[model samples]
Structure formats: structure tokens, C-alpha cells
Target: MNIQNVTVIGAGSMGHQIAMLSALAGFDTNIHDVNEEVLKQARHKLNKIMDKWVGKDKISMEERDRAFEKLYFTTDLEEAARHADLVIEAVIEKLDVKQDVFEKLDKAAPDHAGLATNSSTIVSSLIADVTSRPDKVCNMHFFFPPLVMDCVEVVKGEHTSEETARLAMDVCKRMNRTAVLLQKEISGFIANRILFAIQKEAMALYEDGYADFKDIDKITRKALSHPIGPFELMDLSGIDVGYYVMLQQYAETGDPKDKPSKTLVDKVEAGELGKKTGKGFYDYHSRI
Candidate 1:
């Protein structure tokens, strides 16, 4: 399948970068969001990012300009999906919200277009049955800060066709990303499952007063040689994102142990959603 036109639904942290990558790959890319303010913010943030890339000699000025030329921002979902050969949904992690977006995409996107989700934890199988084209639906899970992250998990849903998986992998290659194709559906997939275990242990230690969060982070960075500690990474990725992922896992398994930690719940309730919100596990307000 030749994917010429790409559409990204959502203009938040992950969506905007994914759209930029598609545009950088020479695809006609459209980014859609319900909020015009978010569309404005995405455009501003993307410009800064591309400018940084040019300054670092990662991409030429001409390349940045050409990529922006192919990129578009919109508030209309139908308009965004109408000409798309592939549509990647990067909306909130909630299952009902994703299902609603896929149902709308099924109605608006072309008959041959492939629908993918950039969800971190929610598997596409839970979402595919809502759309008529279950065979074309798969998980194209891109990590946070996609421009910097090189890997994409192209997961095949229970009903997803092999062709759809191949098309997703091809799209990843076009974006200069390494794609890891998973044959079966699994919640949280590979990287996150492993990361969550580390995070869970970190949180448990912190909550039990066995170690301070900062000390725990320091130990991981110094002792374990991790570039960033679990707390720092959570702050970078948004505390609410991990909180929601935990909630989803709890919902699926009815496991009380899977619930979000008190620290996460408290941070989310306080609207400290990480770097985006100026405060999460750490305060970014001082830096700003």
C-alpha cells in the first residue's frame, strides 16, 4: 500500500510531532484537533522544534521549509481524513474516546485508508470492533517526544490484516523510525511493560518511605546508569499519562495493585501534569 497522504488526529504532545515526522517524510500531512487553541500551540511548538533541528544541522533550512509546506493544521476531522491514505489517532488514552474517533474516521476516511492509534497502553483490538474496517485497524504506538524517539511499535490487532501491519511498518520506515512489529496484541506492548515494572518498583519504594523519590532517581541514574530516573521520566511524559495507563490496567484486570500510586493521583488532581503543565513530580515553573 502506497501511503501518500497522512492525517493525525489530535495536536497534543504526541500528535503534532507524529504529523511533523510524516510531513518530513514527504507525505502530505494533516493534523486535526477539536480545540483551535491546541492547533495554534502545536504549530508554534513544531516551528520551534524544526528551527532547533536546523540550528543543530540535523536538517537543512530548505528541508524544514519544505516539510512545513506539506504540513497542515485543521479543526475539521472529515476534512483531515478525506484525502488521507493513513490516519493515526493520537487522542486521549480513554477507550470510549478512541472508539468515537475510529468510528468517525471509518465514516470519513477513504475506503482503502489504514487507521492506526498512537496509544501507549490501549491495544487496538479493544478499539477495532467499533469501526467497520477492523482489518485495516492496528496500533502504530509512537513513544513520547516522537522526533527524538527512534522506535515505533507496530502492533497487529486480533482482526488486523497482515497488509495493514506491513503498511504501518512501511510508514515508520518512511519517517526514519525503526519499527518493531508485534505479532499479537498485548496491553502496554513491549517497552512500556518493562518500563512499568521498573516504575512500579520505584513507586512502591518511594511510597513505603524506603527511599525519597529524588534519591531513588539518583540511584537509578548513578547506580543503574539510567539516563533519567523513573520520577523524572514520569514528569517528562506526564503523570496523568501513567495514571491513566494504570487505571486502564486496573479496569481490565480488576487488580487493586494495578491502581495508580497516591503520588500520581495527587499530582494529577492538582493539575501538575508534568512538563506541559509546569509541575508534576518536579517543578518546571522555575525553569520556565
Candidate 2:
């Protein structure tokens, strides 16, 4: 399958990064958002990053210029989807919001256009049921900083066609990334499931006074050789987002083990929303 045009819904972090990454890989890319200010900000941020990459000789000046030329950002979903061979939804982490997009895509997109979601938690199987053409839907979960991260999850849902899986894997490869194909649907997929399990346990330990948060972080980094500790990573990723994610998973499965740690929920409730908010498990107001 020779895919060319890509339409990314949602101009948030992942959506913006996907647009940048796609443009860098020479696809005819379009990013759609409801808010014009967000679309403008995403474009500006991507350009700034690309400029830095060019300055560092990471990408050729010609390629950087071409990347800018390849992108098309707009507020029109139908206009974006009508021309796309692939449509990737990276909107808010809400079922109704996602279903609404799928409903639009089902009507607006070309028959050959395939759908993918950059969802970190929602299982592909559950979301695939949103569309009449479930065979066309699959997961293309990209990691943070998609322009830098070269790994993606090409996840297959229950009704996902093998051809759809191949198409996603092929696109990832073309974009100069490694794609790990999940042969079956699994909640949280691989990385988040394994990583969050440890994180949840570490939070439990800290909450129970088994260790101080900082010490837990230090020991994990020192002993297990992880690049960063759980709380530290959560702070960087945003405590509120982390707490909400775990809670969402718990709400879905009703498993206490996967529930949000009280230590985390409380901090988020108090508006200590990690790095983005300047205070989480660590103080980010003064010295970093």
C-alpha cells in the first residue's frame, strides 16, 4: 500500500508532533483542530523545533524547507479527511469525542482512507467499534516527542484487517521508525502496561511510607537502571494527566490494582499538576 496523504485530527501535542514527523518524512500532511489559536501555536512550535534541528545538522536545510512545504493545517475536518489516504485521530481521551470524529470520518473520508488513533490507554478493540468500517481502524500509538521518538505501536483490534495492520507498519517504517505489531488487542498495549505496573507499585510503596518519594526515585534509577524514577517521570508527564489516566483505566476495568494511587489523586486534586503546573511530587517553581 503506497500511502501518501495523511490527515491528523486534533492539534494537541501528539497531533502536532505527528504532523511534524509526517512532513519530515515527506508526506502530504494536514492537521485539523477546532481552535485556530492552537493550530497556529502548533505550526509555530514545529517550525522552531525544525529550525533547531537544521542548525544542529540533524536535517538538511533543503529537507527542512521541504518539510514546511509539505504541511497543511486547517480547521476543516472534512476538507482534511477528503484528500487523505490515512486519517489519524489524536483528540481528547473521551469515548464520545472519539466516536464523534469517527462518525464524521466515516462520511467525509475517501473509501480507501484508513483510520488510526494515537490513544495511549483506550484499547483499539473498543474504539474500532466506533466505525462501520472497523476493518479500517487500528492503533498507531506514537510516543512523546514523535519527531525524535522512532518507535510506534501498530496495534490490531478485533475487526482490524491484516492489510490495515500492514499499511500502518509500512507507514511507520517509511517514516524511519520501528513498529512493534501487537498481534492482538490488549489494554494499555505493551509499554504503558509494563511501565505503569511498576509505577503504580512504586506509588503504593511511597504512599504507605515504605520510602520517601525522592528516595524511591533514586533507588529505582540506581538499582533498576531506569533513566528516571516513577514520580519524577510523572512530574515530567504531568501529575493530573497521570492520575486521570490511571483512574480512567480503573473505571474501565474496575481493577483496584490499576486504580489511581491515592497519593497521586490527592496531589492532582490539590492542583499540584506536576511540571506543567510548577509543583507536583517535586517543586518546579524555583530551582530545577
Candidate 3:
């Protein structure tokens, strides 16, 4: 399917950047959020990011201006989805919230518009049944901070049609990102599943007093050659996000082992959600 217009349902960390990428790809992009303040902030953040990109010579001023011209922010979901040929939902990672959005998107979007979720763990199969066009619902999981990440995971749900998956892959290509197509749906998909295993082990080691979280992170970085330690990565991605993902995983499998760790629970309860909030596994107040 030919996609010209794109809509991103949410104005949070992931949604705003995804909308920017769509606009940069020459698509008429609309970013919608229930909170008008969030829409305003997203617009401001996008401008700052684009300015930085221009300064770094990643994009020319003319190209950035053109992208801004095509990008729009709205508080109305119906208005955002109306002209969209594709809608990527990047809302909070709660199944019920996503299903609610997908149901509404089903009614608001055009008949041919493909609906995708940018969920890292929640599979599209669990969300597709809520929409009338289950075959058009697929997972287009973009990594955190879409601007720097070049890879997208395109997952085909049980009811998702081949055409819908192809459309998502094509859209990713247009946005100058690599797409990895998964023939079958799976919880946590590829990268996250591997990352989760490492995180789980790290958490266990920390919780068991085998080593301090900082030391574990240092070992991983120095010995394993990882770009960052698991704890640092969790902080970068938001501790609350990992907490919710763990909750979702436990809910799905009824396995106690999948439950969120005590450290994660405490961090979330304390409202220290990493770089965005200036605290998580590490303090970011000084840098901020």
C-alpha cells in the first residue's frame, strides 16, 4: 500500500520522534496527544532536536524547515487519524490502554489505513482483535529514541495480513531505517528478549548481594564490551517502562519469575524514572 500521510498516537518520548521521522521522510505527519501541554512540549522538543541535527550537519536547515512544515500536533485523535494512511500507536505500554486506542482508531481512521503498535513487548495479536481490521494491525516496534535508532521490528500477528506487514516495512524504508520482519508474533520479540535475559541476570546478581549494581554494570561494559551496562540502559529507557513490561510479562505467563524486581518497584514508587525525571538507577540531575 502507498502511504503518504502518517499519524502517531501519543506525544511522549517515542511518539514525538517517530512523527519527526515520518515528516523527515516527506510524509504529512500528525502527532496527537490527549494532553495539550504534551503536544506543545513535543513540538518544542522536536525543534530543539532538529536544530541540534542541523548544527551537527546531519540535516540541512532547508530540510529541517520542510519537515517542520509537514509536521503537525493535535489534541484530537479523530482529527489526527482522519487523513492518515498509516497510524502508529506509541502510547503507554498497557494492554488495556492500547486496546482502547486501537478500538477508537478503528472507527476514526480511513478504511485503508494500516494500524500498528510501537510496543516493545506487547504483541499485536493481543491488540488486533479489538479492532475491526485485525488483518491490518501489526507490530512496528521502533527502538527507544527513534532519531538515532535505525532498526525497526515489523511483526506479523496471527491475524495480520502479509500486505499490512509489507506496508510497515516499506514505511520504515522510506523513513531511512532498516526493518526486520518477524513472521510470527512473540512477546518481547528479538532484541528485547535478549536484553531482558541479561537484565534479569544482572538484577539477580545485584539483589543477591553478589555485586553492587554499579560494579555489575562496570563488568558488563568492560568485560562484555557492551555499549552500556544493563542498569544504565534501563535508566536511559525509563525504569517505569521496564517495570510495566515486567508486569505485563508476568500477567501473560502467570510466572512469578517475570515479576518486577524490588529495585525497580522501589525506583518507580519513588518517581525517579531516569533521565526524563533526572533519577533512576543513577542520578542525572548534575547533567541536566
Q: Report every candidate's CA lDDT.
A: 0.95, 0.86, 0.96
Candidates, ranked, lDDT: 3, 1, 2
Alpha-carbon RMSD, each predicted model: 0.7, 1.6, 0.7
TM-score of each: 0.99, 0.94, 0.99
List where candidate 2 sits over 4 angstroms from the true fold: none
Clashing pairs in 2: none
The superposed Cα distance between candidate 2 and the true structure at residue 203, in angstroms, equals 0.6
Cand. 3 TM to true fold: 0.99
lDDT of 2 by residue, 1-288 (tens): 688999999998789989888887889999999999999999999889989998999999999899889999899989989888999899877666787888899889998889998888777667667677889999999987688788999898779999999999988888888999999887788998898888888987888899999999999999999989988989886776667677678888898887777788789789997887899888988856
Which residue pairs in candidate 1 have backbone atoms (N, alpha carbon, C) closer than 3 angstroms, thus clashing? none
TM-score of 1: 0.99
Name the candidate, 1 or 3, with the larger lDDT value: 3
Question: Per-residue lDDT tens digits of candidate 3, residues 59-177?
Answer: 99999999999998899999999999999999999999999999999999999999999999999989999888999999999998899999999999889999999999999999999
Model 2 gets an lDDT of 0.86
Clashes by residue pair, model 3 = none
Clashes of 2: 0
